[model samples]
Target chain A: MSCEKQSPPELPGCQEANGPLDFQLRILSDPRLLAVVRCTVAEFAAVSGFKEDQCRSITLAVDEALSNIIRHAYNNRRDQEIEMRLHADIGCLEFTFVDRGEPLDRSKYCAQPLDAVALGGRGTHLIRQIMDEVVYERVSEGNRLRLKKYLPPARLTP
Target chain B: MTHLLDDKRDATPMKISTRELNGTTIVDVTGEIDMSTSPGFRTALLESLKKTPRLAVNLTNVRYVDSSGIASLVEVLKAARISDKRLVLFGLNEPVQEVLQLTRLTKIFEIRKTEKEALEV
Candidate 1:
């Protein structure tokens, strides 16, 4: 079976946490999904310990990674459903994108940014610089890319 | 993965506000930049280049940029290289700076961290 045809391992936080303190988002590859995901992150920020900068990192990373899939993985073809899941938990958040398509060229991508300023190649680069940790995997039917970013360790205050 | 945002407007997110400072037209951009929006960005920046030898772009309000944003900037760079005019970036946000660093583009163009610095360079 293609990796996409298989289900993802149950995510770490989504299956464990509950409350106004947490969030989980799952949406198909539609570009409009950014709104719902951002709103969820906003909610996590408002009620939990995260600040805006931390949230924006996740948002932008997700945006870039997904944009890459939209542009290259699926090649701007809308027929594929880009699935994303965000889990905000204890000290950080984890975001995942799953799509059943061809594997990407790892060599073609570097988290490092370049200034040749070509129009089409910026997507993968953006995802690496902004997010704390990025991992790419190929499961049975599809490709999985996950990003994780940590909030500052909680401060000890008076 | 399908990362396309489903905003109804389909209008480009980048906005243009131009000011003539020291005889150069400085175009300030504010908003999210992407494929849907970068073409407009390219259009606006290129238009500014036509009328002046010096163009300063203030990117302070630009919240996010993607390949398209870089492309638009590159477009300006190409124009500057060919025209022998100067195009500079001012008020680069962290995300923008991060993009430049990864691309190693800082060496190619004059970048100022603030509007004042950009104007001076």
Candidate 2:
């Protein structure tokens, strides 16, 4: 796990003026690293004022995102690279994942119904349900997925 | 009546062991279950299912579970239904219970609070 502190990206409503906490993480696309990522992100969220249950939910969302990248984007290649950026502002927390693998088909990215009993395909649903915003962009180099969750007023600190 | 298998890998953060109690196969799992460990979990589950008509999983020591773990449980449950075998899960910590509720899978599986209840069910 390699991580560095960096300036937050310039996205709408997320500005430097908000004093956002920014972090970038780079890791090999190994399934074994999923637990490490979950612990890191969950602790980060907790320090940002999220409750225990909310932290767990956020951790699960991030875990699912990384899992999808390992399975679909990198095609189960453990040696590939995957980068994640976490930006936590006063109002929201955002995660950006970048990977140079098979781009996800936007037209085919719908959450499977929870009523169906399936072996797989629940990762996407869990992410969408847990996060406030889910966006996928096919970049020139690879694919980028951004997930966001708004913080409640009580949880937001000065 | 006997301990069937005990599987633990030095490279993985999961351990699985199984024993028989009153004709029911009790699978005790310890540690986190994620993409790296779910395959072994699935195999252990399926193998236990093959040995008896009733299988009870003890998840009291499991602290975390990812989507892959849930998928493994679903697959084993499907197989149990097909073979007329029983699959019961007990001692789920809060995180594992919430994951099942979030996926709306609590409606499908038989969940108990204790090993005694799991065996009775």
Candidate 3:
């Protein structure tokens, strides 16, 4: 885990003169690290002014995203590396995940319908429901996933 | 509680212990249930289900759970139903409860407020 302050070049709604707060974490793809990552993200969201419930939701979303990377991209390879970056501005929080593993198949990434009682497909659904924006792209090296959650109107100002 | 069937304490992030209470099997789980730990949870649940027709899970100490953990419960529930066994879960914290609600699985599983209630019904 590392923390640094940098101005985001093209973020649309950043209002702070100092720029958005940024934190970066690099960890192995081991599932044991999920709990540690969740704790860090939860505290980071809280420090960025999200309420408790919002913090929990954001934490869960990040956890699910990392879990997906470990399962689908890395194929449960424990030694693989995953990098996560979080940017907090006045209007929204953005998370970017980069992994050097197999790119996820977009056609197969759909969340299963909740009506059916099934196993193993609800993670993607939770991620979609919790985050306001989710985008995935395959880079030359591997994959990148971005998730954004906007703050409420009252909390939008610095 | 008369017999302790299995008590698993390992290097993993979660701990599971099972005991027989009257005629029902009670599984007490402590720690986070996530991708790293859900497999152990599923194994414990399935092993207990095979031993008793009635089972209740005590989640009072579980403060966090993810979709994988919930999926484990769903899998065990499905197996229990197939074998005409009853599975009940109780003592869910807010985060765990919200996960269940978000997944719309709160209605599918038999949930109770306490072990007594879970065992009785």
| Top candidate, metric lDDT | 2
The candidates' interface RMSDs, in order, read 9.2, 9.7, 10.4
Q: What is the lDDT, from 0 to 100, of the residue B45 in candidate 3?
A: 97
Clashing pairs in 3: none
Report lDDT (Cα) of residue A91, candidate 3. Answer: 69
lDDT of 3 by residue, A1-158 (tens): 11121222344565553356899999999999897788788767766667677777888899999999999999999999999999988768999999999978777776458646988788888899999999999998789999999877886553
Candidate 1 off by > 4 Å:
A1-36, A42-48, A111-122, A154-158, B1-12, B17-22, B93-108, B112-121
Number of colliding residue pairs in model 3:
0
Write down the TM-score of every candidate: 0.71, 0.88, 0.88
Candidate 2 DockQ category? acceptable
In angstroms, the error of model 1 at A93 is: 1.6
Model 1 misses residue A144 by how many Å? 1.7
Q: Write the per-residue lDDT of candidate 1 for residues A1-158, one digit (tens) a residue.
A: 11111112344768533331333444555554544455455444433445445445556567678777766677776668776666656555677788887788777776334545565566666677767898999888688898877656652110
Complex DockQ per candidate: 0.28, 0.38, 0.36
Supply candidate 3's per-residue lDDT for A22: 92
Q: Write the per-residue lDDT of candidate 2 for residues A95-138, one digit (tens) a residue.
A: 99999999996655654686579888888889988999999999
